[model samples]
Target: MSKALLVHPDDSVATLVEPVAAGESVTFAAQVVTALTDVPSGHKVAIRVISAGDPVVKFGFPIGTARTDIAVGAHVHTHNLATALDGTLDYRFTPSVPFVREAVAETATFQGYVRSDGRVGTRNEIWVLPTVGCVARTATRIAALADAAHGGAVDGVHAFTHPFGCSQLGDDLAGTRSILAALACHPNAGGVVIVGLGCESNQIAALLAEIPEARRSAIRTLSTQLAGDEIDEGVALVAELVALAKAERTTVGVDKLVLGVKCGGSDGLSGLTANPLVGRMSEAVVDAGGSVLLTEIPEMFGAERLLMDRAADEVVFDRTVKMVNDFKRYFLDHGEPVSENPSPGNLAGGITTLEEKSLGAVQKAGRAIVSDVIPYGGQVSRAGLTLLEAPGNDAVSCTALAAAGATAILFTTGRGTPLGFPVPTIKIASNSGLAARKPGWIDLDAGAVLEDGFDAVADDLLARLCDIASGAPTAAERNGEREIAIWKRGVTL
Candidate 1:
């Protein structure tokens, strides 16, 4: 195998695909260099001489600055590098067109359930939501019993419980209510049952008021304060909704598809393998006249410009700027720097700075022109690429994607995670080891791209996801891993 990989021609360092012992000779970029220090797999090794205080380049961008003079083949990471990003900066609208288009002309279709409201759903499932934390367990019990009793009725039953709706004031409570309302109205959910304690700050009445009138008919609400037997009552209500949801299955074109994109537990090979593979899938779906939602606002740090320049119009460009800066301000307002990322896992996996991570994370969006922007807890407003606002937390961002009407989420991870969201969350592993280690967690392996090339692997991944859209369960679904967490941006009373 090759000793290391040079991601871009301008990169000053190369990523080691395997451990390199000290004094070992390896060739990179047509030059032979001896290793000055032992570097593990996925770690960076300097391919050229870099003076102290000079930028340490990777991914063809300055990830950080060298803390000290770096010799050839020296390990380049936290000890030798530091982030150059500070607070937010001014941004301008400079549109750049994507040279390559990944969308196709022919129509691709998936089997889905069509609701009375004319929305298409990849699954026919019932979602149980608790308006207040006090009734969270109550919602879970109802879901368990309903799923057991009506196993053959629809797809499945799930309960998403969150610790909110009580003691939360202002926007925090509003955020909780809006997110719950959004999930309750998601197209994947054929039916919904919202349970409430009746006295919490988030009332069932106010929550229902936020849902569209047409969607309300498929939603059933209950108050534990009034119901004689909440569990039985909920199951009965679910039975009625099951009957409504079991109507019929129809074939829908790619235009009816909305795919959510995210990456978590990323490693050095993420951008090279899994992320870009998902990007190809994104371009394919977007080109076929479908919508793709990209969230995790804070993760867009150094790579925001790449997306901004691809904005379809000035209006979208402006909105994209506001979203990026607003998220940065949220961090500054909390006395945290905008570059507070590349967590402990990320560091161990060879990621050095937020800039480096962002550059890789945004690859999931591919080269498609961003068509629109959606606020936190908002749904997709248009087709093609749409950016959504949410923090970098995995659960929160994936939940935001699901709440925004994603039929299925394409989640790439170099370091594996078993966490799954409400809708089908397909975990694509960046390296072969992780995929082999977590067969039950990973749905597809992007590691094959190294041998089979991106086009072949991208085609395989797109077909796998299309199968998932057409009633084939993902590894997460097979493992029974469905969860939801809301973004709380307010204070508690």
Candidate 2:
């Protein structure tokens, strides 16, 4: 028999790590009760009888309400319980007073690669950015050439080619340009080779003009037509840039680090462990004069007001609101409800609605004041916590954050995920079971918080954060999982 943990003494439910047969005696608290139904891993079981319409509590908070009468030892999940949004009540926001410690004023630092523009990087690599769909193959060829030329000196050459960048209008085209420009200026990138087809609507000149002047010199533009479609010439150009990038080495401080916070494969333990631990580390980075980015706009659905209240100024607040509303509009325009987030895995893991998931997901931002709200692919100039406009899709969100100058990322998972970004991504497992089961993917086990305390887990997380930033490879990095996906809005045509 495997153990099921009761997160808090007041928690009405306990999570089961293994299936419990009906009629089997299960010890909960100091009492033993017969299992009313078979409860599977990642599912919850009621310790006491619950009536219909009664709130089902987990983590000592109402996760949802029972749709039908539930008996003691009964399985608590989607079939029996429904989300709070299905009920007719507005939730009041009572700010949680987290235990605080005296501020650490001393600067904690890390060694990084410093750019000429005063920006710093954790990794140095050459990028092959395709400006149009027509030249994506050319960019891929360049990546291959650069890899062959540089051998193992360069981290790796990549072609960030996408489906769009042509046949778009208004904000769609503008958004593509902004995203590409941001990638060109990303700290991880030592140099960029923009490959384009001469007649494509997304011209190289327009993309160059959008980049900041300080980073413009590192960007080299080449067109397939100009290169006479000769793959060798294009390969040679990429090789030359790769040589320049390989010569650059790492050296800077932790303050120069820009970290991206993201959560995926969430479970009931997300709020109880990994997210909060990451939040503490995020605050530590901000206090050290480093920047952190918290994105996934739709994931902020129910928690937008919390962030708005923390906005540094009215301008930042308004931008935050607009970003939230824009995501809502985008979802509705696609004939889908905004609440259609939190995939089946999340639901299976006890998260019911977007609101429930949002409340927990926002915890990754910690208590930092919102400094700025940036659109997808927008440059992150201001420090502190920046609200990036992006969807909750892991690949798309991580890609956007990396493009926006994040030198590394801290990714939280609950149900087990094995994905990494182009930059180093530290995977924090929300539960010990997942960590143990998928030891190859999870780098940190935040599940200790459930058994020990939040403070202890937070200390462990911060230590791991420092180690990861200092060139220690995360599980995702070791697995060679460099996943990347750009969020696409508007028509695909």
Candidate 3:
């Protein structure tokens, strides 16, 4: 294998496949150059001379401006590089190649619970949810007791708790209400128990009103203040809902699948390997007439155009533009720079700027055209690829993905995380080392792409996902890591 990968022919820098020591020579872009200093693996090494104020190119795009003169084989990172992103800029839609929805196997299917409302579910678990933080413990106790008593009858009984339901005003309260309503309506949960603290800002009755009347049959509500022994009542309600959520699984067409594509704890190899692998899987699903959802809007800082050009129509293009600028304004409104979204962990993993990270991050969508844009608490309005509004935080974004109607989430990572949302999150590691180290956390190893090739690894990943979607428990589910986080965007009263 080559010591360094020149991502594109125009790239001024090349990423080291492995760490290089000072005075060690590496083959970069067909040129042999000795390293001036030690460069960590996945970090970029300058392959061409770059002067101060000049752009440093990677993935055939300017990731940042060179802070100082960079010579061949010198390490290029934060010390010598700076983000090139300014504030929001004007954008016009420039169409990419015309999208042709490819043909897929007509008989492609997965074992799932087909809901009466026409949505497909990958699980039949009972979910106990809280309307306010005050009864979060009660909701959790209810799930534990109920699952223990009736766990044998269903897949699993779990509670998704959060700290904010009261004290939030405006969009915050609305966001909380909409998210809980969406969770209550999630197809994965065969039965839902919504436990509320009666006097909280998010009342059980008001939140219930947000859900459609046709979907309320599977949902049971509990008001802690008015109930006699809320725990016992909650458990008994869950028992009653058991009959509502029968464990009958039927084969569902792939067209009914709604996939959430996300990446967190990423490293340099993420863009090159795992993200692209997930992208391939996304293309296959989309071609099969299934839906794919991509979030982490802030991470699209510099690379938003890639998605913009793929907008399905002028309307979608406009929505894409607004979503990108709105997120930038959101940062500026809070006194944060739009270009400084990458974390210290990202830097350690060889990501230098938000631009670099964004380019890598957006690859999870593959080459699918943008079909729709969803608000913070909205579900996928149409199929194909929908871009959802949310931050890049692991928990927050995954939770939003689950709330947006994803039955299974394809999560890519170089660094590992054990947290899972209401849906089955299939963690794919960018490198084999992380997968080997955290076998319990990772479901697929995209690191194999280095040796096995993307098509091979992706084929393996898709098959595993179908099995996971067909009732195979993910590592997160097996470890009992079910969780949810509401996006709190407004102020406290």
Candidate 4:
């Protein structure tokens, strides 16, 4: 494998695939340059002289402006680079990217639970959701009791606890209700028991009214206020759900699957390895007629146009424009920088700016056309690449993806995280080191892309994911790290 990788011809720097010592000769993109200083693996090395304030290009786009004159072979990172992004800006619908539809070959399939409403689920579990944070512990206790008694029958019994639904008004209350309603209808849950605290803003009756009519039969509701014994009532409801979800798995086509592509704790190798690998998997799933949801709006700041240009129609392009600009306005509205990302872990892992991160981050979408753009807590309607409105935060974005109808999430990480979503989260490590060190966190190692190429790795990943969809446990599931976090963006009374 090459010691360094230059992602684009005009890039001023190349990513060192492996750590290189000072004075060591590095070859990238067929060009040789001696390292002037020790550069860590996944870090950048200047390939050419860059004047101060000049743009540093990567992925054939400017990532940031150089803070000082950068000499060839010198290390390039936050110390010498600063984001060029500011507040919200005007956008035009210029859909220039061509969308090629690949013919599905043989049509891949997985064994999944097919719901009565025609939706497919990768897991057969019972979910307990609280209508208010006041009942969070009660919900957890109920889930624990149910899992201890009834987990062996279905996939498992789990509860998603959150601290909202009360003291929230307007969009905040609506957002919480939407997410809960979405979870209630998720196919993964064989039965859903909605625990309510009686008079919370997110009342059970109101929340149930929002759940899809087709999925309402599988959902059960219980109010602690009306229960003779809240825990006993919750356990009984969960038991009923388990019995309802006890249906056998059936062979379903890949098109029935909804895959969520995301990356957190990203390092420079993320773009080259895991992200690209996940992109191939995304392309495969899309080609097979499945839907792929890509979130992390702020991470697409500089790379937004690339996605916009691939919009399926003028309406999608317009919606994509709104999604991007609205996120920027959100940042500016709060006195925060629009490009406030490449978090500490991201920088430590070698990402310099949100642009550089965005360019790499968007690779998970592959080259699919944007079929739609869903709002913060909206459900997915089409079967193609849909851009969901969400922040760059991990748990919040993953939860949004789950609420948007993803059965499984493919999360690529270079730095590693133990967090998991309400759904199955298959962790792909960008580097082999992280995979080796965090065996309990990573399900696949995408570093093989550098040695074996994306074709082989993606093929393997797809097969593994199909197995996971058939009820195989992911690293997160095996470690019992399931959790959820809703985006609270409005007034909280």
lDDT by residue (65-88, candidate 3, tens digit) is 999999998999999999989888
Residue 54's C-alpha lDDT in candidate 1? 98
Candidate 2 or 3, higher TM-score?
A: 3
Tens-digit lDDT track of model 1 for 291-352: 89999888889889999999998999999999998898999999999998999999998999
lDDT of 2 by residue, 1-493 (tens): 4457676777777776556888876665566666787766666788888899998776566666889999888878878877664211233333343335554523556666777778887777788888887777778877887677774776777777777678877778888888888888887888888888888777889999988787776777887787765477666766777667754555455677798999999986686578988888778777777889999888887667778777777778777777787777777777877677779889877676666688789889888888888878776888889988888889989988988889889999998888888788999998888999999999989888767888777777766776677667789878867756766666655
**Model 4 pairs in collision:** none
- In candidate 2, which residue ranges exceed 4 Å CA deviation? 1-14, 17-19, 23-35, 47-50, 59-61, 86-100, 103-107, 246-252, 313-315, 437-439, 448-460
Which residue pairs clash within candidate 1? 103-287
Off-target runs (Cα >4 Å) in candidate 1 are: 29-31, 102-105
Q: Report the error of model 2 at residue 59, Å.
A: 4.7
Q: What local lDDT score does residue 335 receive in model 1, on the 0 to 100 scale?
A: 95
After superposition, candidate 3 runs with Cα above 4 Å error? 28-31, 99-107
Candidate 3 vs. true structure, TM-score: 0.97
Candidate 2 residue-wise lDDT at 323: 78
Model 4: lDDT of residue 183: 84
Task: List clashing residue pairs in candidate 2.
Answer: 110-254, 112-251, 112-252
Write model 4 residue lDDT over 1-493, tens digit each, in one string. Answer: 3389988899999998899899998899778999988889999999999999999998899999999999999999988999999877777878784756665423678999988778899998899999999999999999999999999998888989999999898888999999999888888888889999898988898998898687787888998998899999899988887877778899988888999999999999998899988888788888888899999999999999999889999999889988899888889989998888989988988899999999999999988888999998899989889999988899999999999999999999999999999899999999999999999999999998888988788788988998999989999999999899999988778
